[model samples]
Target: MTTTPGDKFSYKIELHIHLDGAIRSETILDISKTKGRPIISVDDDGQETVITDQESLDKEIVITTPCSLKLFLHAFNVFMPIIAGDRDAVFRIAYEFCEDCAKSGIRYVEARYNPHLLANTLDKPAYARERGDFSPRDVVITVCDALDKGSRDFNITVNSILCCMTHQPDWSAEIVSLCKEFKDRGVVAIDSAGQDFEPGKDPLLCGHKKAFKEAYDNGIHRTVHAGENGPSEGVREALDHMYAERIGHGYHVTDDPELYSRCKEDGVHFEICPLSSIITGACPEDIMKHPLIRFADEGVNFSLNTDDPIILNNALADDYVLANKMGLSDEQIINSIFNAARASFATEEQKKKMLQDLVNVYGEH
Candidate 1:
């Protein structure tokens, strides 16, 4: 009658969420205090950076309006530094993320972020050489080790997705090598995220070409950020050039019928973060206008995610509820969750156990 023989169905899977942006607001304040760093630092221009308001940090961290993705990304800079300078900060925030997920009943999550970005404190020798936090490889391992510990402690799974920015082609090889070295320690897949296209640049990069090829050759699963800020062509490039098994926020694919058909036929999955799409203006805040419903109508496989839950002020449960408001039935919403687990980079044996646990809890929707 049941599969996994446990109450694992109380667990859920979230395939896409940014590690840096998803840290709790209260945790940011806690870390800032622990590190003795100013919650408010500034740029060269002297604009006060991060949260200055000691009185209302929670009120301030949550962005409550819609804007372009570029502006939407600025929120990350404020709190990223809190975790960047110290290894302990990384461990605490990452562990807390898993702990939060466990409390929320999220069994597994694929957390993604640029390893280089997290190592910003290590970027300048003048600023970092003395403190000695300056190794990207070490930074990545610190984060992964914390996640592994969290997984064991929380009895929840936290998989890492190392994101390579498309513009910064130089970092690709190093990231792939890091994944290769740390795959056993919960580094499951590779991703290319941020700034899909610029005025003079292609969304797809040659460096990723080499890196993803190596990942493919090694049988590592990969995904790319596309069709959210960029055009549908970027989605095609991800599917064709990088051999991406999943497309991140590919909202614009609905603009092209032929490409939509191709993706559905290929069984390629989309990690759709609805509220993030709304906040970034990729889709309207009004669910009725979103192309997601159309994409679903055409049999496109997809999974709902929070993208950056703390940044978006949403969660996996919130996403499913939003899909219901978007006119998808309860069955469809649950199926999307199932799709998330199926599309995960976890091994087949792991998946089987997870699916059985899930079905025992959820009863195959």
Candidate 2:
């Protein structure tokens, strides 16, 4: 079991937590029962099987073995019942996410998820035909407000990255417009994630480069989930075609010497989530031989994150312990923390404060 990091590393940062995937287990149960939704689970065979009861609900929440990405995604079915277009549930989850991060000593975190997924519930006949004043834009507003509230109420900083799923419609322009509308609020970046392999999505994304251009032209940072489930070429496409500023789980950059060198030259940071990689079958080996050491050794700029804390039953402190488990030294972990701060989307002032706090805690590592 991974324990929390020791006292030397006092300040923590989370750059890649998914909002829905990180929802509290208690909240999941409450939403499932309250909404009369079926408690669901995906067995090792990647089949959609019911959770049966509370014991299964508890078990399915965390994965102990390598699982299919398709099956892993099915686990999200439980949350769709709650987060799909319900403003109260949206605000509550957003608030609780930041609050929980604060309690974990995460001073600054970037919460990410496909806004389109959250909008799935809103698109239903009941929400559209019955409610006249509502639109998807309002969902964006509510979530941003909740993040702001979480920052205020919990005294921790929270920010969001809107996602554009490659397989789905490219609402990239609409998402960009929403980010611009609330840029002064908590919304910060735009991301390309999900179903990266299929050719249908790639051409669709290629055709919608205007949306990416819109975000880039409007000054929103871009990140893409590449090299996780797909080959390293996805990482190349993310950088060359999509104008990505950073690459999520770009571990496969190492698969190609040129790509690794290109990212190195560009200073594109990798958002590495060790436990998520292991749980989702992205990494065939456990933490010990994970690409973290290789990436660090090769001078690849990267940051450790709790991609889905609730999903993997992992924590940011546990991430530090994980680094140790990977046989990384305390000095390397400290250096990586500073590296993450440098690569973060946080403002310079926030980054300065973070480093200042780090200095006070670890004292010139």
Candidate 3:
């Protein structure tokens, strides 16, 4: 499909996606049944209702509700058991995520997950017997292999990042090592994800400095989650201290002009997930009122992404449509795509190829 200069261009690169957050609902049900966990239910109205042995609630518990930051983090905890067990399960999730991306017209993407969380949940009984020395490095490797195979199989490109949860200091070194191990196998970068639960806890406390230093020293790229649930200081810390090349959900940066200016000057990209931000209460209710357009207008480079497409009921197209609704012109939308391509961890040659592909596809009449 040829795109006109004035027409909407679907440039396909997703920089801020979460792996577990992208699992299909049917897959969730299948995994729940296979793992013998509590069955999730749906009402006549077609709303999901998950009942646990520990608690009971009648209404559908939407993960995208605008609540406190803690509640937003709790949303993903429900899916841990469903996604963490078998290699095939992870493979299937990766496959389905890619399928969804294809349907959304996303040509390339970087999906992030903390393999430590997946490993801890999957290897508990086995590791208990082995005195806890067993690493889920194999599982991480398997997931990467699945991603590689899926990319070739589906004719859609996808990359992954071993997200080191900022709350877990003990596993930082191991996660960094995993990134190094998978450096050549399409593991493009490292991420700091999950909730910043404690106010006293520093955003850099998860040994991100050490992890980023190690990854940078080893010639790996870094992207850190900051300013979503914390202050602008957290964003600054990620850039200045942890050496993040990209900041995920940096909505709070609107409050700090100096930090915003620095990011623009340094060419650090921000992966802004609009629907996810609305669902997680990162922004005010309206999309037009979002600070994303302001940032874009100010020349703060960023890419539109579906942070948790499944949970937010969003897709790449949704992000683009919302961008238009937020008063961004076609050229501005194209600029966002270019920002994503520029921030992508793909090699310079690969990036050039992708950019050329985009220009050829969309630049044509």
**41-100: candidate 3 lDDT, tens digit per residue:** 544477766664322321223454577766655555555555564667777887777777
Q: Regarding lDDT, does 1 or 2 come out ahead?
A: 1
Clashes of 1: 0
Off by over 4 Å in 1: 1-9, 41-46, 49-55, 120-131, 198-204
Q: Which candidate is the best by lDDT?
A: 1
Q: What is the C-alpha lDDT of each candidate?
A: 0.78, 0.74, 0.74
lDDT of candidate 2 over 207-249, digit per residue (tens) = 3466677778888878888888788888887787778888898
Off by over 4 Å in 2: 1-8, 34-53, 120-134, 198-201
- Residue 223 local lDDT, model 3: 88
Clashes of each: 0, 0, 0
Model 1 lDDT-worst window of ten: 1-10
Q: In TM-score terms, which candidate is top?
A: 1
**Candidate 1 positional error at 142, Å:** 1.3
Clashing pairs in model 1, backbone N/Cα/C closer than 3 A? none
The lDDT ranking, best first, is 1, 2, 3
Candidate 3 local Cα displacement, residue 163, angstroms? 0.7
Q: What ranking emerges by TM-score with the best candidate at the front?
A: 1, 2, 3
